[model samples]
Target: MLLPYAKPPPGDADHALLPPRSVPARSRTGEGFYMVRLLKSALVLFIGLHALFYALQNIANIDAAHGALAYVLSGADHAAYPATMFFKTGNPLLAWAALAVVLAGELAVAFFGIKGGWDLFAARSGTAEEFHAAKRSGVIAAGLALLVWFGFFMSFGAAFFQMWQTPLGTGSMEGAFMYAMASAITMLFVSATDD
Candidate 1:
């Protein structure tokens, strides 16, 4: 005995169908992109602040003769050691080389951060293909920035060790270690946001 009406299987032509799943609203996507941009902006602002602080510290330490080294050496402690961690009395070339390395790292970090911000913004608004491309670019830029910062952070220990070995100063290596640790914390935050 056949029922008066029998329901067709889902795949049957007679079966009613639901509409295809819709992509998330554009507004939602835009909001996500905006949040990422906001984060990148904050990171850039932090870098600027760090740069300003470094510049101010250097300027404040300049001597009356407008000689930076003179002012630094006048101080009775780590102040006298060459910025590159070399002893002023030991080897001038080593001091210069260290300074150059530090400066180069700083410059690279600044450039990478700026480029990363732009790339992140682009990835946020772009199509899937474009987003992936931008993501790769941003990751590289960010990785370079991290590398530069880490190099300087590690150098702090060497600088402090040089200071300790030289007659330039007497202090525990705790300060240098602490600084490196703090920097690591900042790097961790930056990396976490990248994901």
Candidate 2:
């Protein structure tokens, strides 16, 4: 039914019933599909490197990070609302634990992103099924990115710890939102099925 006008060119009944073999599946799909695979790889790699460098920076400035967490948890300048924080703490152990969780999450995202990006890049010239299979790691990275930024920073830090009260906290929340949006968009773009 695909090529009703085209005949099997002086062939037997079995051959005549089959679709034309001249046109390839690749020709029907075009090159844009391959370009999308490449874009997915590049975007994931960018997010991976961004997270990796941020983790490194956090390690380099451990004292600063710890201090920031301490200040946020202490609820120092939360004058906007009269409601008191239910879980305010100045313990170094708690702050350190929080920082560790963040670092671990970032490192995990970096690992998955880099690995997935490389897999996708390597499968660019492969069949569509191969490229689809290569997206597993990238999808995981994107999900972790959402968990880190939206779940940890925005929901936990901002809502629970009241991190949006201070100027520094507001800046951090905004940055987290931006990163979350980027990862969400990338996830959607990379997950779309192509024919």
Candidate 3:
């Protein structure tokens, strides 16, 4: 059979696993790559460090922090909460457990996010293939950040703690959603392969 070009087409059986060009993920130097890399790195660090700071600050005063958490859990003066059984439980153990999970997640985000940013920075001078390969850390970091804000805070705080029922509770939800979206969008940007 005749061929369209000298080599097999990009999606053909012979080239399904190969790049059309020499380097698969490498991209030509351009403004878009730098912009995406910068934005992704900043977003990862921004959310990760912010969560770490929150966890660190709250650790010093567990009693006060749990007091606030309990307040949010109770839905404040709002009567629209699903139920109040958890509030009546009145166990510091549960609060401590929640605090521990959040703090751990925060630390993970901070560590992974920083590592991802460093990887990207170090690869800036290398080939686009190197930059693309270095993005693995950033991807993991961004995922952790999203999980911390959305999976942990939004789900646990709003569902378990009923944090979305009151002004302060709602405020927490808004912040969580914001961080989650920022991390998500940054992930999308960084995941884009450039020529």
Candidate 4:
């Protein structure tokens, strides 16, 4: 029996009898929650800034940049590797078009990744739910980078343009593979949600 204004102690059978009370679940910090957030924000921002600066610096050098593509086209002449025979027309304008496409994707990765990191950092004090919500942009940004560097540069460039033949180019198979891997790992890390 309960007295007026007197509640039974928690864990008491009397307390249990009180219509199955509801309690909001407390947020779980678990291990390294903050550290994971820090890592995510920093890595994403680094990728974004790295790509942004590289693209911005190179955008002004269109002729030189386009010329790099010309070097790849030379692989078509390689008797040891006739991959370039896949080309219907090795027009210089088409080369510039490819470069433009790459630059656009880079700009997007830069913008989305940086902005996503910023969003995560800004929501640092928010609840775990808010933090999870903030990851959407970062995920999209990282995916975009993976798609461009891995899907486009490595896949299309290697398969279509014979990018693997380059000895010193960053878009060479080796370098593109590295960039793609980095973006993929970052994307996976950023996509993690509290379990």
lDDT of each residue in 50-140, candidate 2, tens digit only? 7898899999999999898888888778888537647788898999999999999999999999998998898877677887899999999
Write down the lDDT of every candidate, Cα atoms only: 0.45, 0.86, 0.72, 0.74
Q: What ranges in model 2 sit over 4 Å off? A: 1-28
Error of 2 at 1 (Å): 26
lDDT of 1 by residue, 1-195 (tens): 954655657677444344555554335467766565556545544553453454355345533213322222233245444354343333444444544554555455455555655665655544545544544433443444445444443344334334343332222234334533544454455455433
Give residue 50's error in model 2 in angstroms. Answer: 1.4
Q: What is the TM-score of each candidate against the true structure?
A: 0.49, 0.85, 0.73, 0.78
Model 1: number of clashes?
Answer: 0
> For each candidate, how many residue pairs have backbone atoms clashing (under 3 Å)?
0, 0, 2, 0
What lDDT tens digits, residue by residue, belong to model 4 across residues 6-107?
556776755654576543222356446666777888888877886797688768887887887766654544444654456634678877887888899889
Q: What are the runs in model 1 whose C-alpha is more than 4 Å off? A: 1-26, 30-33, 44-89, 127-149, 153-195
Ranking the candidates on lDDT from highest down gives 2, 4, 3, 1
TM-score winner, 1 or 3: 3
* Total clashes for model 4: 0
**Lowest summed lDDT window (length 10), candidate 4:** 22-31
For residue 76, model 2's alpha carbon misses the true position, in angstroms, by 1.3
- Of candidate 3, the 10-residue stretch with the lowest lDDT total is 20-29
Compose the digit string of candidate 3's lDDT tens values, residues 33-138: 5666666667656656776687788787767778766676445565785566565335667666766777788788778777887777766656767778888877
